[model samples]
Target: MTDNRQSLADLASLTNQPAPAAPAAQSLPTSEGDIAAPVSNEPVREPMPLREQILDKQGRAYATGRRKDAVARVWVKPGTGKITINGRDQEVYFARPTLRLVINQVFGITEREGQYDVVCTVKGGGLSGQAGAVKHGISQALTRFEPVLRASVKAAGFLTRDSRVVERKKYGKAKARRSFQFSKR
Candidate 1:
């Protein structure tokens, strides 16, 4: 039997080509024991393109937000901080302190309290859900008004919509998961 395999050097010689060069050795450390940082061969990445500010002819930023069964339409403009919901002041619309806090959380995180005016209309859900919807709307409007704040607001997890909703009831169940009472004879 004849050997068919050929070494890389033998193939190179037959092809009239020089052998491939070996990888370079790592640099030695200096007498001070300080080793140079390794250089990366990776290409440098370019920074992401910035988002553009969106505004209406009236100079207001508009956005819509939804949570659970509630939906809110919001408009943001530069002014002393004032929030109106459903044609009423925030205090009147959301009497509970916690609800008010939920509505203002975005502003608090951006450290932009008392710097803008917000007008929103929310419907279709209970108080808690409505408050959440309003908060989501405000965050979206703020980002639209000042695109630079997008990174911070997104980092705080306000940009993503809340997708949780009530599960549908099954045909044989009393509620989504509760079973009907059994009868004993």
Candidate 2:
């Protein structure tokens, strides 16, 4: 065994390879230590922020939502199912049941309907766009309040903004995608 070990070392020496060095001891700072551990040469990276860090003291989460020309500023808080849009009750503001449903779709998907109170002020765009914007806002605010629900909400695609917009009319066209009457009489 001694001869075998010596032969291995001798082979390494013939190859001009230095013997392996022992690992250096490093100490991590403990709870009792006020002194920080030595910094490494690598750049220190800041920790990514989580959804929980974006909340107000009153447990309200706020988000801005946009759809086409519509923009909505929304606030979400825990309360009996109450939704106000532009100081009017949701039903009153969104006369169409479909529009009202659009605004509440996020809560329904999370199965958290009637749990949060949502209030929003919307401007620009038509009623349909406004409803879509409110849905986007509610989804965002819900995520901020509880990060865990992000998966469900995101899976429903509520987190993604709809990019569809009206196409611009060409100079020679009567309307977008509609060319002027072709008369070769």
Best prediction by TM-score: 1
Residue 157 deviation, candidate 2, in Å? 0.2
**lDDT, candidate 2, 1-185, per-residue tens:** 46666776787799998744322312433456555567679997986555554788887999999898899999999999999999999989999999988988898899998999998999999999999999999999899888888988999999999989888988888998898889999
Worst 10 residues of 2 by lDDT: 20-29
Q: In model 2, what lDDT does residue 174 have?
A: 96
Report each candidate's C-alpha RMSD, comma-separated, in the order given: 6.2, 9.2
What stretches of model 2 exceed 4 Å from their correct place?
Answer: 1-50
Question: Candidate 1: lDDT of 107?
Answer: 96
